[model samples]
Target: MVARERERGFERFITFVDAIVAIAITLLVLPLVELTAELDDYGSVSGLLRENQAEIWAFLLSFAVIARLWFVQHDAVEHVVAHDKRVERLLLLWALTIVFLPFPTSLVAEAPEEPATKLLYIGSMVLSTMLLTHIDLLLVRHPELTDGNGDADPVDGAANVAMLVLALLITLLVPATHYFPLLLLLAADPVARAWHRLRGGGSRSAREGD
Candidate 1:
């Protein structure tokens, strides 16, 4: 009975997290909606889209990022059989970062040309990723928190942290290269795998979470 109740409680927590993530994802598109009001002013719809291409790209980029973050969070939760209060707190913190994303996302949409706005948007993503990494670390350190359903992979966390750190450095060192840091995010997994191989430890299946 106790085990069943614990699982039920964990399910509720996961549901709540999912709801928050869904809301956050929905919020990501809100900034783009305002662009519709000014559509006729651009002479044509296509022209308006073209004129606001930066915002469009920002929206798409942020959407993709948030979607990926949600995936990571959902995947992590699936491994959890029972929850610790610390893990719950970390999950809430992670959700807070996810919710905060839209604010920076809007800043990017409003001032896509500004270095500060771009940095802020990327910085927000980096923070979100870091929080997720911390959660993964906690899981790894406290395997008792999970139900043996999945193995926690810390390499994944390391790769993400490395990627974001490098991205931040590039943004700082090369302000002219707008949005280039985003490319690192896409490369994170491959880079992480290679890192594991070079280290001569950790099986491929394990590194890839297979």
Candidate 2:
């Protein structure tokens, strides 16, 4: 009972953290000036949206990507048991990054045409990936956090590594790609997830036979 209570407390804390991330994601959609009554031009408003289509696309894309990343992070953390101060300390960094990510997401949308802006955006993603790597390293260092002693899903580990590589490659294109490659990630996600699931099932079946 006491153990469950302690878990409840920690789970509540994580929930709060997740809430902050959601709000941060929502906050990225801003500075949309309303069309005034004097400027009752629907055409003008539509034209404005069209002119800033890249920014709008960036906003939507970043929102989706960031939300997906947060969902993954939350799922990973839920299954993980920090085991020691080192692992616990890394969660603090993770939360910090969660808060900081919005700045880059918002910036990317606002300046999609500018190369520097894209670089800044991709830099944030790279930092997120690095932090994600550090989290995985912690999990590796403390194998107790995983089921079947971290060897159960070597394929999943490989998929994550591949995804990290893909992200790093995409990052290189940055503002020069003008969010083209970033948009392409939308297509890659489903395919990668499906491949990962297939590999996981294969690993499980092999383990069962053993």
Candidate 3:
């Protein structure tokens, strides 16, 4: 009976996390939706697009960021058969970052040139990514919380966190860069794979051969 209850609790926790992520992603579009109200000011739909390109870009970027974060979180917990208080608290804090993302996203759209806005937007991302990294590390430390599917590789999360920190630093040092540094995140996966190989953690086939 206790096992059954724990299973149900895990299911409920996962469902709640999914719901929160969905809501946060949906909120990213609300600002764009409100743009429709100013249709008259722009004179035409194309004009509106031209004038509000920054807002549109910000929405798209954040949507992608949140989606990627959700995927990372999902992968981290895919093998989790149970949860503990620490995991629960970390997940809630991660969710809080997701929910707060839209606020800084809006700020970026309104003041793209402000260092403070850049800090707020990218800083939120750093915090979220850091939380995931911590969770992955926690799972590595406490294998009992997960099924014996496979070992967790926290290198990916750590690599991402590093890339984001680099991006944040670039933005701060070069204010004119204007979010371009974020492109560095695209290299995170490759960097992680390289690091893993360097650590003698090769592909499954290589390990099997060994």
Ranking by lDDT: 3, 1, 2
lDDT of each: 0.76, 0.57, 0.86
TM-scores for all candidates: the values are 0.88, 0.66, 0.92
Candidate closer to the true structure by lDDT (higher is better), 1 or 2: 1
What candidate 2 gets wrong by more than 4 Å, as runs, is 1-6, 33-44, 81-84, 145-176, 183-210
**lDDT tens digits, residue span 89-124, model 1:** 888888888888888777776766576776677777
lDDT of 2 by residue, 1-210 (tens): 112222454566667767877787776676343323423454587776766666677667777767766855654565553344564566567667667766766676565556565556665655555555566656656666544233333333344445544654665654354455554444444444566567564443244344
The candidate that achieves the highest lDDT relative to the unseen native structure: 3
> How many angstroms is residue 28 displaced in model 1 relative to the true structure, after the best TM-score fit?
1.9
Model 3 residue runs over 4 Å out of place are: 1-6, 203-210
What would the TM-score be for candidate 1 when compared with the true structure? 0.88
Q: Order of all candidates by TM-score, from best down to worst? A: 3, 1, 2
Residue 90, model 1, lDDT: 80
Candidate with more favorable, higher TM-score: 1 or 3: 3
Q: After superposition, how far is residue 130 of candidate 2 from its true place, in Å?
A: 2.5
